[model samples]
Target: MRALPAALLLTAGGFTAAVAQQTAAPDTMVAKTISNYSAKYMDAECQLTKGHYKVSSGATYLSTAIERGSIPENRLRALASGRRVITEAIQQNGQDKNAAAWYYLGRIDLHLGDVAGADSAFKRAEALAPGCAQDIGKYRRVVYAPIANKAIDFTKANQNDSALVYYRRAAAWYPASPLAPYNLANIFATSKMDDSALVYYDATLKATMVDTAAATVKIRNQAGYNRAVLLTRKQRWPDAVAAFQQYLTWVPDDADAKKGLIQSLRAAGMADSASAMEKKLGVTAGNPMAPAAVTGATADYNAAVQAYNAKNFAAAAAAADKFLVVEPNNRDALYMRARSYVELKKGPEAAKAANALLAVDPMSETALSLLGAAYNLTRSSTQAVNTRLRLNALPFTISSVTAAPSGA
Candidate 1:
């Protein structure tokens, strides 16, 4: 997936070396520092292309270091040192004059799960000169494309083992791309390879942190939901509860997920809480909402879906919103609205819808889906994690917590 437009924020006319020279006196120290790191970066790229697995491994390690929650002391020190130097360069000489420094900082920020920082730095580098630091096209053509092709061909032949190897190769060569790990996780999950699926699922989430392109965001949404499913299957009650709750924020009306959440709550020794939730959700009721309201909401939802099916995302969002203004807690309308925002690439707007939906039903599947996408798009990993934690801590102690109406 390509980086977002922010990473290509340069104007029509790119900066030239001559222009840079004329801008101000060259800070020799900053230039030398950036040049040295640029050489190392290029060397790493070259080594990766030459089949040096270590280079790719280090890249993968760096990409996932922050996402994994804990880091070895030595690795932490190395990361801090690298970031320090890059910050120093930027402070001493503005990013515009030191394109390489910006480029390296982008790479570092991307690896550290700071997508916004990375995109800004990449934009600065590209603005300095088109060929400077953050060139994804060359990397795609030279590295990712070939291996991805091989992986696809192998998958077409039903050669899972061969496909897995190539997929791993692609992921290892460039950990920034979510395609490899996401697909790998899907394949493993489908094959009931739980352990393998978990590993790739983790990788998929981590990779998504670096690149939140539309395609990657979709994949990340799927991975996040499915990882929760896997956790439930493994009987990891606490984790499953958190995952299912998180998943619901994206897809509020997923009946299966709702049932799973209750099951997880019970299994985690919260049977009383689960029973209360079941009662609040009216799980045993034959029909909940008044028929008139249901019919109206359904009609509005269908109209929204029709627009969405026509790929008129803006229309779909508008229709959903029109319905939501009347039926604020209509699960399907909330989902359609949030999803349309996602398709429209309005990350902040999408997040607003998702957050609003969450306030009514914290476990809405559709809202949660868009929430993850929005957070990734805005590079708000900390916010996303904190949101999950807060949701996980929701009091479901028997009658202590009252569940929202299930669109009834």
Candidate 2:
């Protein structure tokens, strides 16, 4: 017969018998159902000594070694011996074996690359006594981190289905890992699966909020911004305004967000409210109603605006297009084109024009509102809902901001 590797032999039949004989279950060890196991067994006070079957302590020792690095040859053998004893004790003791045993069993299975078995065992442990393990955090690091990373990589490659599986698994295994929801939300958003994306985005925001670490804070901040933008695009004007306001709390001077807030307010049909916000933001004589215009395109801008106000959408769009040809950066012309598209119920065209306007002056409330309306008119209900929810969560108020210079 050929020699077998230690790992193989331990998992096979030979060592199991030897170890079972040495650590037989004690007569005093009363059997109890998994769901009714003694708390004493789960606590650290129950140390493993000679002739005692303490599964969790052994699991802790083995798992700690595995997390530190490769299990030494001696330690590997010891763990194998411990596993055999635990198996025998569970079989003989029946319902008497503590649920912590299953938790430990899961840890061992994970070490052996039997993820399915490990998951089953963990579930069993939880079924018997929910949250039986005293040191669950270590198990999460040993198991879930690699899985979450794989999900992230899959997302990066646009392998969304595979990423979804791993991300969900990672979340199942370690619910507190913000990366899981964040990555899942990102993939859904990219796929235009707005419903799922919004769910995960909300989850990510909630998880990140409780963490005060620098990295977590940064993630939370970005989550707030992204959520608010999504809300704005959904045309839930009131919600979008609220979200943008929330975002401003963290990033008070973000011009784009401020513009977004203003647009949301106006879209909500709160013109007086919008005007009040502009004042609080210190938009005064210096900062005119319109963004700075190219000197030569002033006449074209005035003509476009006049046509728009007159409800001559087609004529307004034409004039704006002509102005854009001369001064592509003219904010007023871009706004007119976008407004005309909206009035004409041309969702795609409106979105295009609004996007162009945003590119030139990203902090224009009017443009943000227009873009959001475009999403709604396009029949993207999920997208619209997500946008509204995200934007409504942001901070919109600001203090002590000088208006644009009195006259360009």
Highest TM-score scorer: 2
Per-residue lDDT tens digits for candidate 1, residues 216-265, read 66566667777888898899998988988877786675654666788788
Please give the TM-score that candidate 1 achieves against the real structure: 0.40
Clashes of each: 16, 29
Off by over 4 Å in 2: 1-97, 116-134, 269-271, 280-408
The C-alpha TM-scores of every prediction are 0.40, 0.49
Residue 327 accuracy (lDDT) in model 2: 62
Q: Per-residue CA lDDT of candidate 2, range 286-405, in tens?
A: 322445443444556566777887889988898789868866755556777988999999998888897887555443345667788888899877866765654443221111112122
Error of 2 at 91 (Å): 9.0
lDDT for model 2 comes to 0.59
